[model samples]
Target: MTPKAKAATGALTLASAAILGAMHLWEGQRLTVYADKLAGGLPTYCSGRTQPPRPVGSTLTQAECDAIDRQTATEYGRAILACIPAERMDQNSFDAMTLFAINVGKTAACNSRAAHLMRDGQRENACRALAYGPDGRPVWSYARGVYVQGLQNRRRYEMNWCLKLATAA
Candidate 1:
């Protein structure tokens, strides 16, 4: 991890290494701004930031990208800590939810059934809620109202990580 990455994770109460690792694995680095079809063709760059939008052709250095990623992670961490009791959650579970928030957006993740379950002291169920809802149907596995395999795979990965199970390769 870079110094910025360290500083970013330092502000969070959850497990830093795991959270950063998951973010890297899921978000992937993109120094050049590009349209994200899944996000309605919004111009995004630097590990998925869309705010303070950069033009599609804009490019950033690796250090610049890392800095942006760190800032975004810190902001998301604050949001997660505001709603969830990070101190009480196991490292893996908190890490999993942080990744989820990164993917879904802070408000939505904080307002999700998973968050509700965590707040209500249902840890395991909250983890399960990452992929399935009360109806035992998949959730957060769709893009533009259509089921997406990539999203399903991500949810499954998150669910497994939260449960501390062996993740699929």
Candidate 2:
């Protein structure tokens, strides 16, 4: 990355963490609680469409989708926490992981070999695990390696900033 991009990423990372920490400090559990209330249980990325060509559940109403994203985000977060690749992850790590999982998918994110390597404590080798695609396939195939590396880099930044905060505190 260019020096400017790196610097900007650093700034953005800090800002994101500060916001999350502030929310937790002020709202305590309200953040997740409100999200759950809005979800209404059936709130999912699928809305109500159980299959393709079926707009019935493709997208929910605005309120429902918003609530669904929140609820799914929280539920997805719990799964990540239970099986994080690393033993010493902080909330930042978990947040980064959760956000990625939410964006991509829980099953896809956690089952990555790169993720497995990360959990095994091989952060660098884990990065190498980021192949363009397994078996010479394109990212369109199973590019777990590529995305997991990105997630690792993000979590590393979060982990570093978190450590700095802990030390300062």
Predicted structure with the largest TM-score when compared to the true one: 1
Predicted structure 2, TM vs. truth: 0.41
Against the reference, the lDDT scores of all candidates come to 0.80, 0.42
Provide the TM-score for each candidate, comma-separated.
0.86, 0.41
lDDT leader: 1
- State each candidate's clash count: 0, 4
lDDT tens digits, residue span 29-118, model 2? 221112222223422232221112322223345564445444555465655555553343434444555554544467875786645765
Error of 2 at 125 (Å): 5.7
- Runs off by more than 4 Å, candidate 1: 1-15, 165-169
